[model samples]
Target: MQSTRNKLIDLLANNQDKYISGQHLSEELNISRSAIWKHMKELEKDGYEIEARQRRGYRIISFPNKLSENTLKWGLETDWLGNTIIHKTSTTSTQHIAHHLAREGAKHGTIVIADEQTGGKGRMNRPWHSSKNQGIWTSLILRPEISPHQAPQLTLLTATVLADVIYKETNIRPYIKWPNDILIENKKLSGILTEMQAEQDRIQYIIIGIGMNVNQTIHELPDDLSEKATSLRIETGHQLDMIKLVQAILEQFERTYETYLNEGFKSIKTKWESYGFKIGERINVKTMNQQWEATFSGIAPDGGLLVENKHNGKVEKLYSAEIDWFRE
Candidate 1:
C-alpha cells in the first residue's frame, strides 16, 4: 500500500520548480481532494510548509533537509538500501539504534540516520564527532545469510560504493585508505564502521555505519583533526546536497550489493583492485611495537594485505596494521 503522505512528498520534490495542481495530484495518485488536504495537513504537522491556494493547489515550501524517506525515495531508484528510514534529531549513535532495530526483527535494508550523535563510534573505538548540522552520520542494517567472515567483504563493497558516489558527484577522485576509509588527496573524508549480531555459524544481522564529513567547513572540525580531515564541501569548495548525496550512495550500494549477491566478489574484485590504494610502492607500518618498511604487494584473494619486508626478504600476510603511506 502506498502512503498518501509519501506520495505527496515525492510529487512536491519531483516538481520542485513548478506547482502541481490538486486535481492532477488527486487523479494521478487515485485519491480524493479532501484526502489530499488531510494529508497536506498531516505533512504540515510534521514540519513541512505546503502552500495551499485556490488555483495553485499545493507546493512544498520547505522541510527538514536530510536523508529522510521522502528525500531518498524522491532521488533514489532502488528497491532497497533505504526502504525503511529511521531518523532521529539526536541519539547516542545510529548504529546503536540499528542494532536494537535488528534485534526487534527489523527488515533488511533498514537505515538509521541521525542529525547529531553524541557518542558516535568509529572503527577502532575512536570517538566520532557528530555535532548538530555539521556532517552525515548514519548506519544501515543488512541481513545477509553469509557467515561472519564474509561480512568484511561488505565493508569493502561499501567503500567502493561510497568512493564511486564521491567521485561521481565531485569529480574529485578520492583514495581508499585500505579496509575502509575514503581519503581525498591524502586526508580523511569518510570512515566505515561495521558491527554484527551473529550465531556461531549463521549471521542474523549486520549494521554498517558510515560517517562522512559532508558540508562541514574546515574550521568546524576539531583542532586535532583540522589538519588531517576534510569534508565534501572543503574538498570541492562548495556545499553539496547532502540528502542527494545520501540518495546517490544508497542507489549505488543497492546496485553493487545486488551484483555482489548475484555475481559474487570475483566480478568486482578487479574494479576494487584498480582503485586500490597503492599498486607498487614500499610502505612503512606500525603494527604494535616495531615499525617496518615493506614493499607493498597487492591484496590476497581473501582480502588481506600482502607485505614483503625489505630487510629480510621475507613475506607475510597481514590481517591488521596501520599502513603509513604519508611520511609524517
Candidate 2:
C-alpha cells in the first residue's frame, strides 16, 4: 500500500511545474476521482503542500525536496548506481532509513536522501555537519554477495570512485585519506561511510552514505569547520552544475563497484593505492593504545591498513584505529 501510494505521489510530483488536470490523472492512473482526492488528502497529511484550483485542477506547490528525485533519476546515464531514490525532508539518518528499507525488501541500487538530517551521525557517532540545502547528503543501498569479512575493502573502493568522479568532472584532483575521505590538498571535500548487514557467511546489504559539499562557500560552514571543510565550488572557484556532478559520481561509482564485484579487488586496490594517502611514505599514526611511526605500505586484502615499521623492520597490519596521518 505504501508503494502504491508513493507511486501516485511521484506521478504528481514529476509533473509539478505545471498543473495536472484531475481528469487526465484519473485516466492515466486508472482510478476514480474520489480515490484521487483521498490520495491527495493523504499526501497533504504526509507533509506535501499541494495547491488545487477550480479550473487549474491540482498543482504541487512544494515537494519536501528530500532524496532529490530529479538529480537521482537524471544521474543514471550509467548502468545501476541510483536506480531507485527514497527521500525525506528531515530524518534521524539516511543510513538508518536505508537500512530499514533494505530489510523491508528494497531493491539494489536504491538511494536514500535527505534535505536536512536532524540526527545526522558520522564516524564513531559524531555529529555530521550537514547544513540544509547546502550539501549532498545521501546513502546508497547495495546488496553485494560477498563475505562479511570482505566488507571494509568496499569503503576504499567507494572512496576511489568519488575522487575519480570529482577530478574527472570538476578537475579538482582530490586525494584520498586512507579509507574514505576525499581531500583537496589538505582540506576535506567529501566523506564516505559504509555500514554492512550480513550473516556469518553471506552478505545481506551495505548502506554507503556519501556527504559531498557542493555549492557551499566558506561562509556556509560554521566558524570551526570553515578552515577544515570545503566545497567543489570553493575549490574550483565556480558554481558547478549539481545535477551533472551527481550523475558523474553515480556513474563512476557504478562502474567501479561492478568491477570490484566481478573481478577481484585488484583493480580497485591498485587504483586506491595510487590515490591513497601516504603511499610509500613514512607517516605517523596513533592507535588507541600508543603512537608510532611507520612507512605506509598499502591496504591488505581484508581492508586492514598495512604499515611497515622502519625502526624495527617489522610489518604491522592494523584492523581498526584512529588514524591521524601526518601531513608534512
Per-residue C-alpha lDDT of model 2 across residues 235-324, encoded as one tens digit per residue? 888877765666777888888888887997888878888788778888887787988888888888766888888789788999776555
Instruction: Assess the local accuracy of residue 227 in candidate 2 as a C-alpha lDDT between 0 and 100.
Output: 89
Each model's C-alpha lDDT?
0.82, 0.79
TM-score of every model? Answer: 0.89, 0.79
Question: Which portions of model 2 miss their true places by more than 4 Å?
Answer: 1-67
Give RMSD to native, each candidate: 2.6, 4.7
CA lDDT, candidate 1, residue 251? 87
Task: Let me know the TM-score candidate 2 reaches against the reference structure.
Answer: 0.79
